[model samples]
Target: MFALMQSARLESLHLSVDPVTGLKAVIAIHNSQFGPALGGCRYLAYPDDESAINDAIRLAQDMSYKAVLAGLAAGGGQSVIMRAPHVESRAALFEAFGRCVEQLDGRYITAIDSGTSTADMDCIAQYTQHVTSTTAAGDPSPHAAMGVFAGIRSTASWRLGSDNLEGLRVAIQGLGKVGFALAEQLHAAGAELLVSDTDAGKVRLAMEQLGAHPIAPEALLSTPCDILAPCGLGGVLNWHSVAQLRCSAVAGCANNQLTNLQVGDQLERRGILYAPDYVINSGGLIFMALTHQGAQPEAINQQLLRISERLTGIYAHAQAEKRSPARVSDELAKKMLYGE
Candidate 1:
């Protein structure tokens, strides 16, 4: 693990284990060059401790690049709690986790992500004030979905020759908070929706509420659609899956959508426009950062509007340079962070 961290150039790794509350967590700070580290607390069950540490390290690095590209005055960090069979004492676990955050002494800030919720943030806030995405700040998922929606429209405008989503077929491969909210926006815009989720209830909800067609989770990528939106977990667009995609473009709120950097080249070769995941799904981070700084709601919203504009410029630059959008975005983010 030390060798991996050294190879990845991680800043620091902190592990906290509380036997009484059964809380086992890892906080990985990837960078603090821009400012204090800011990231979400992801509580999930990993196969092993190594998996948890690896996830924290990778996610923390992504957050650093994401913050720099989004113009947020924060660095990158992530907290991953290994889930166990102690659901009855979840609050105690969170409180213990909060204490861990407090120990960071403002170097790392925590927010809601994946298995964690705003209520969980509230629990963490009890032990430390360095938290965001609480009830007071409202849910960041909708804002994230909004940014992805804007990116999808921008992609359509560039690739399909129009930004209008009317009658456009969109396959959404997840019905989580952000995915469902994104479905609402796309449906309102008259887009034809094909939704899938591991949860049957969520798929049913989309079908009943948004009039979306149901697609099997395993078949979401290959399903014929104008756009493929992956709002679920990462690594869906791997080398094998990239060859199977039938969509004209890929855009969603999921982090690290591509399994490897080479997948971007594959997408380009397949003639599919790829919206860089961090660039498109930065609304949540932007919201949490500005809210932490006490920015007004309007100011937060206006900042989110820049997401689409940034994506548009990236797409245009990619076209002008005849390069992949993913490559272009990486260069831009690196230039912003390291002045390369």
Candidate 2:
């Protein structure tokens, strides 16, 4: 535990177990250089406690980089709830989790992430004030999708010599809230959609409603397309998938899309333009952070659109320096956060 904390430069790690509600949670604070640590609470089934801890730590670190790159006056933290079999009483579980967040006393703020929802945030809000994405704030998935759409346009402009998505083939690997919303945006822009998801119902819905061609989940990565958008989970772009990717660019809403730095290098070698995940996928975080500061809705909407500008700068720098966009983004974020 100490090794992981030290390696990730984590400032704090808190573990909470509610025997009555059967909630086991880990909260990791990666940095507080800019301000209070801010991130979301992720609820998911994990293989083991060690895996959960590793995920919390790694995600917290990414949040730190994400905040710095987006110029948010906050640090990075994450909360992970381990979903166990026969878990009973979600309200009790989240209330207990909210208490854990309350104990942090605003040092870390919690929002919604995958496997969690706005309703869950509303439940959590019943216990603590540090939570966002409540019933009033609504879901941030659409805003996140907007950012990804803007990123796709910028990337398309650089890679395909046009910013238009009309008739451009885009294979989206998830049809969840953000992915489905993104599909709506792309479809309205006249992009050809190939979608996949574990849920057959979602895949079928995409096919029927949006005219998206449904691909089996297993075949999403290798399907020939102009862009491969993995909006589901992280670690999907490892060496094996990178070698098999048949796309000009990869950009989506998933966090930690690359397994490691070397995988990003491999994508560069393969001539795939990877819009660094943290840089392009920061829209939701930006929305949450700005809303937390009581920024007006119009201001938040305008700020979210700047994601394309930020990505364009990163792409330009990558081209000028002859480096991968991932490397350039990492270096720029580190310079902003640590001046090194």
Candidate 3:
């Protein structure tokens, strides 16, 4: 399923794949009135070229909304590199991507996305100077996870009417960089934890590091918890899955978590305080925005703290208006885009 629901506001889009260079990339630029496009580079295996193109278009559209919500000056764009697990490719893929970016010439600045890391960006930098990886000085996952944790705290405080989560039972799905960092923060706050991952190494690491209970990925969502954190992929909460979840609140760092707008409202209808994914996942965007603005980590961190406030405000507004958080957040995002 595609992430974009369809909108006439969309200005332009582009998609391509370079086979001769042993590179498969789909780059889409959605809107650029604010400035040149900037989005993450995701390495993944798609079912077909159409799937890759669809993901590129959808994520680029999401980037437009995300950029506006984060109050950034750049437009939206995203690139996806299709590859099999450990499939042989090279700097050639990035170099070919660099060539694509050069053709665009600053219209799209590549950043480290899923299936990619900063080290990958190091290779990508050889091709284009407009590229950006999470130069977080420290581990990017911790920083990325910190933003999500801060958002989670704000969400729990707003929803539960309690800022102290000494005995809160939280289930984290995904022990990747973001998940591990979030688990660390939650553990520090005296929260009971249950974490799981597809990677046994990461699961073992989380078990050793945070003393979390390991479980299969499919079971993580229904594992009877106060808050369900999905820091992995999109479309985790959908028509078939939402009705089965037992969490009090849904919050995480993944983009496009809901299959559609109505599903978010369904969660709200079920008395599940759903923290809008776009709103909650703004941490990464916020970090990227600040970096794009040439700010230091301290300055960026200080600014990121306000996300708690922004999320809190959104929560309050949603409650007061009897609106879904997704709708409320989208209203806020659209306001930014429309300059209303």
Candidate 4:
């Protein structure tokens, strides 16, 4: 009951076009204790309207907590689009989507997310002025990659008791912009990599760039490795998928990775380390605030480092109380912002 009430503070938007393509659109808006609601617009080909709506609700809620945890001024929000290929390229729907954002009048600022690109945001920017970028001058992806990499290192240190990533076999699902960028960082840190994606081109590029071994999408799930990173969509780590996993730690940039809220306890029972998704993937949001305010990296780095500290504390609290990391994360975030 305590957990359920904390989850209801998020607001959501739902849009869909039926019979034509069965595509749906959803947006979530999480307001700030500090300022207005802000985040990126994500476009994806979801299975249905309900899925999009669920994604929007969960993402917006995650953003709200993420902002609080990361010590940012803005709150949480995300937009989702379910589309049929060629009918709506990101170029078309994203800008039209920006029209939706314009109506919000800075109440919610949209940037980039999964299935959305800077190129997509560039188009969206034409429609609305309340937009943030990872690349206005210094793109946030690389910096975000750096922060997540730092987080991974921190996780390794906590879990493995060693800072060295050498010879660590990490399996990454969905090598998109952020994942690919992260792969390079891990490579530099001496981690052996296994990567998978639906796009053959991205797989090939990852193999060439990071020297990662490629696994097909189906095969990617059960790959025997140290870390299981999901950088794609949400709700991948459920009762079903958790039964299929063959890794030690779960980490990556996917939001709402848990299908049910209790799955983190299930992972812990299975002897798997679960790095809460909102905590690890928060670099994007932190970077958004940093760039939006035109601050230097030095100052922003301090904020992102706080994410690591927050994770460390959550892990400790979860470990001590035998609680799920996600729940612990929520409590800690609420504690920081609202004095809970």
lDDT of 1: 0.92
Whose TM-score is higher: candidate 2's or candidate 4's? 2
Clash pairs, model 4 backbone: 40-111, 134-139, 134-140
lDDT of 1 at 335: 85
- TM-scores for the candidates: 0.98, 0.98, 0.92, 0.89
lDDT of 1 by residue, 94-139 (tens): 9999999999999999999999999999899899988899988777
Question: Cα lDDT of all candidates, in order?
Answer: 0.92, 0.91, 0.78, 0.77
Greater-TM-score candidate between 1 and 4: 1
Per-residue lDDT tens digits for candidate 3, residues 211-306, read 788878888877898899988878888998998898899988777788888998999898888877766676676676567668788987886677
**Clashing residue pairs found in predicted model 1:** none
Model 4, position 60, has a per-residue lDDT of: 80
- Residues 55-170, candidate 4, lDDT per residue (tens digit)? 67777878888888887878878777776666635466666776767877777787777666777778778898778772453456766677778778878877888869999988
Worst 10 residues of 3 by lDDT: 1-10
Clashes of each: 0, 0, 0, 3
State in Å the error of residue 250, model 4. 1.3
The reply for model 1, stretches above 4 Å from the true place, is none
Of 1 and 3, the candidate ahead on TM-score is: 1
